[model samples]
Target: MVMLDADPAGYVYRVLDGPLPEPSRGGLIRLVGVFEKVLPAISDEYASKYYTQARDLAALATEIEAMRDE
Candidate 1:
């Protein structure tokens, strides 16, 4: 989840280091669902940004699944 500081006039978000943290099973499911809806309407200008976010979410999911195999 993206978080921001509580400032009425300014915003500060939390940045993760290295890789995106894996969401819980339920959260991942929700992310996948949101992506399904968002991908179709993504325009060319923002495609690269959204594409990277989508890829990161997918990668996080994969990493989580792999950890379960251990």
Candidate 2:
């Protein structure tokens, strides 16, 4: 789950506890990339949300990397 600010400006929380379906990973990565690209241009409110989302994406990526390490 992902939560934005009260005004839907920035990202606040992201939770990834379960397995992600194969088909969704690509799209998810794409979305994360888009967010990373646009984050700097947005308002502080939006940037905040983007920051959290980006953090979540980074965490997810790290998890995947660790899986490959195994």
Candidate 3:
């Protein structure tokens, strides 16, 4: 089962406690790379709001990588 909860601050994506399927894993890898590549430009333009978003993305990427390893 997958559940998504969203609010003004951010979102939470909950899924079964196991490795993600290949497609999802691949998508996350790409997502992380894109965010990393764009974050500097985002910071330069958007500043604080984008910094918070970047921090959140980094945290999510770390969690996804740990799940992939498991």
Best by TM-score: 3
Off by over 4 Å in 1: 1-23, 45-49, 52-56, 59-70
lDDT for predicted candidate 3 compared with the true structure: 0.48
Give candidate 1's whole-model lDDT. Answer: 0.43
lDDT by residue for model 2 over 1-70, one digit each (tens)?
Answer: 2432221222112224444455545545555665566566667895667566665655465466347548
The prediction achieving the highest lDDT against the true structure is 2
lDDT of 1 by residue, 12-41 (tens): 011222222454444444555655566566
Model 3, 19-50: lDDT tens digits are 55667566555555655565566545546465
Q: Sorted on lDDT, highest at the top, how do the candidates line up? A: 2, 3, 1
TM-score of each: 0.42, 0.44, 0.48
Deviating ranges (above 4 Å) for candidate 2: 1-17, 45-69
Alpha carbon lDDT at 9, candidate 2: 23
Candidate 3: worst-modelled 10 consecutive residues by lDDT: 1-10
Model 2 earns a TM-score of 0.44
Clashing residue pairs in candidate 2 are: 10-49, 11-49
